[model samples]
Target: MVTRRDLIRWLAAVPLFASIWPLLRLDDARAAQTPRRVRPGEPGWPTPSDWARLKQQVDGYLIRPESPLELCRESPDNAECLALFRELKNPYFIGDSPVLTQTCEWVGAWRAEPSAYVVAARRVEHVAAAVNFARERNLRVVVRGGGHSYLGTSNAPGSLMIWTRAMNEIRNHDAFVPSGCDGVIPPGPAVSVGAGAIWMHTYEAVTGGVGRYVQGGGCGTVGVAGLIQGGGFGTHSKQFGIASASLLEAEVVTADGAVRVVNARREPDLFWALKGGGGGTFGVVSRLTLRTHELPAVFGLVSCAVVARSDVAYERLLGRFVAFYADSLCNRHWGELATLLPGKRLRIDMSFQGLGKEEVATLWKPFWDWIGLQDDLTMMAAPSIVAGPGRLRWDGTARARFVPGLVVFDDRPGAPDANFFWASNLAEAGHVIHGFDSLWLPAAMLARERQPELVDALMGATRYWLVELHFQKGLAGAPADVIAAGLQTPVNPVVAESFALAIVASEGPPAFDGLTGHEPDVSKAQRDAKLIGLAINELGKVATAGGAYVAESSYFQKDWQAAYWGANYARLLSIKQRYDPHGVFFVRHGVGSEDWSDDGFTRMADSD
Candidate 1:
């Protein structure tokens, strides 16, 4: 019944009415904005009462920064703390705390500090409770097994750390039955170890106590969970298989705080992901069941050092070593640590399982003959063969009494530490030294030598360069189908076809002067590391074009996804998304980690 002019006047006021609606609603919203419930220490941080309640819920103690424990007392220079730090089995706890000067010296090359709290979980329920508490508080959780992550992903700033070293129980089974196996037990001689157990302790328990062995890392301090999850490789890897291949079952705590037993017959997808997918990405592994091997009574050991006079001579010598290593006998473990000092010295160490000294000598006859022809090279000593435990010795130290998986370096207190940057690459059997026409070419120029410009570039950058090679050909000998099947996991696919792993490393002093009050810059450290890494990568490009070893790779790799996981990255990403939809777990250069940047802080990739 209103006039047309009146209707037009009302329409003009419609825009003004709409603008005022939000203000009226905002007034109501203000009344509803109640303060969040907080504890006593800080407005939002957990208080003493909250910590006390959490302690009652778990079997283990919740250690606050102010706790009177030897590791965390009021006095930073407490003598008890120093003593405890030295004997602590877990390396991560040694140097990770910002307040404590005691650090695990093994990882001095790559050290980082974790901000906030550390939870030393004793039982499965403790881990679950910690996870739930972190989720409820909206705090990020970082899992530290042995604290051996090369990229220092195990510890982060402002994260709730779940330290698993206290859960170090190992149970041996003659005929083990995996969980969810429907009453079907696998073969005999298996060991179930707590995820936090160090490899040295496990090795001693199974090998020294039961006369059984498991293929694990050479360094005994490596955590069982970290090694097995990241594709463990040791001196015996070529004889049996990688550490991941020996996994029978595991108990995992997922992001949902559900404790699930994963194996081949149960939770198959998670099982596949846990093996070689890298640790701290899928879930927290509480326990690991692994197949053990019979220990050999005795084995043959060979040790020698060769000196090269010139760069050309060094190249030829290196090529001969590679060629011989490619076709060498099986069940033989050999390592070459080459350095540019004293012109060039290549340390050759080998151990032959289930073989006598005479047989080992015969096996090495080809290499000995090859060494005799070089005029500029000299074998410092005859390749001596002795009968003893097949322990992989580091540097040129005298072989210690075989303790069956005892880590030679880490067990010692106050071991020398160095800051270094390293990169790794895998070379297929056919591609190793293929450009060389003959093994006996003493003065022949090789690919590396042909590019004099590259050599000049390398010499100009650093004082010393080191190349460490480990020959692992077990997977390569397997049928293609078997290799393909194994590659379905998160392990680097290049390992299946690689005849040798080449690790190129460079060492230098700290960039800044500590005495002059010059603080360390994270960006500058990363930049220096990248330059050294690039030089090493360039030197071994042709020899290791297939892929790179994740454990020893450069931290600043540009094509990290392809270099680490190869074709299996997409599947890994899918699995990561399905299990950890909220991105609960993360490791540097790990699967699905491409979305994140490499700053000292842990942040989402999108934020960068």
Candidate 2:
């Protein structure tokens, strides 16, 4: 739980803005603006007076109550601040904290308050100003880039958000790679990338033009900052290691508001902490310069979704998926499974980079043969090797029915009742659908039948099908060493890679069926997540008894220093203390406070 005092302390650590005019004096500029229309059931259609009141709360921070507009002149070069001043005066712009209103409903949701979001310069100076202002005023600061966090930590009630959507610029220095680095000649092909740059955007810039590219997220929409900072896992991870391993340098604005560039060469501790330390911890990153490589655009990304006939079928599927992934590892392709769907469908999505379609087929033949899908499956290859930078449009209401133990990497089958509750178990991967016949499948089929373009887009650029294995008390015997090696090992072939498993579902209205049978599922289905905690305690009894414990998906509250920091926990704390001693960056979802004297850290403090 991120306590209020912790947040306050974080704010204190930030470097104050240079003696520019206070941000508060800009209120009078919008004193006479009229509010817009209000509609029923609209998420953001506050009434005129409601808008007025909300705007008042927002302006109260920027204006000195008695006199507004006096602060606008302080920083004449601040385009974002000036643009915000103009946009706020408009009737359409309503100021509401996205945290309370939307974050709880959907993890990836964002409100487009024209004046609410600001993308400061790539340089640290602009970041310092934004951080200092938010800290001085005690405004909760939610940082946004890619908006992919499953926890919805990027937005807060009554908080100001710094949206990094506009920071998508990518600059490549052809002489930064080790091969290109001679004693005098700097290094071979290095790229200084913007935090907001998404995987697809970076891919296009790198591979579309030159043959060179760096490791990025599998999902195109995932941004470089969040994904890399979190120790990104992808198909490429098996060959090149996780994305963070490729990081060379990062220009960041610490909690104290001072900008610092940390790398292996300078500020090594900060550099070490940045790799897999997770985002929103020590500072706000503006730019990340990573190592690059040359690769093909039309390489093979293999996928196999196998259907199971019964519990025994599921066991075979698990064994085959693990064995195949292990075998593929020797060949430089990584393997992973999604366990925890209600039914029994064992599907494997594999990626073989730098290989053509024929090569891809040959590499995946053994796995297909093992699953006995060599004849039953139909392989639909996309026309182009690359896709995206497109828009995101979901049907107004979309729901995900997920099981808790699905993220575990170990090959475990479902206990009698696994899908009944919201028990999140410690596993290696996130939710995996049992069969394509689930709700999401029909939806996809409908989309394919109705919107072929959307279907084409999915097939061409993304892993369209997701198959997960549910790790339960009993499913199969222990995974062999060859399989485990591929499951946990890292590679450094073409791009940096890593794996992440998360349980994502919609917090819908009362009418939605996604949450149906919540209580019954837990009682009847052996679906209590707390049991996992018990199992962790009884680790020896289960595994030594011939079961295996997967390590990828451990669940811990942010305050639980052990769970949050993992192996790198100690270094992360030291970095936090050194960089954010004043505590300006505290209000984020996971970051702890600098001052721990008043109250102990606990999950209860995180609740309303």
Most accurate candidate by lDDT: 1
**What's the residue-level lDDT of 593 in candidate 1?**
67
Cα deviation of 323, candidate 2, in Å:
2.8
TM-score of each: 0.73, 0.54
**Model 2, poorest ten-residue lDDT window?**
390-399
Residue-pair clashes per candidate, as listed?
4, 56
Residue 137, model 2, lDDT: 45
lDDT string, candidate 1, 343-435, tens digits: 577777665566767767887888888888889989886677667653332211323434232222333446532100011111110010101
Where does model 1 exceed 4 Å of error? 1-44, 66-111, 183-185, 329-342, 389-464, 477-485, 507-531, 543-546, 595-608
Question: lDDT per residue, candidate 2, 234-288, as tens digits?
Answer: 4455445456667877888777677777776678787666665667666788889
Overall lDDT per candidate, in order of appearance: 0.59, 0.42
Candidate 2 segments whose C-alpha is farther than 4 A from its true place: 1-123, 177-186, 296-298, 329-331, 335-341, 354-560, 587-608
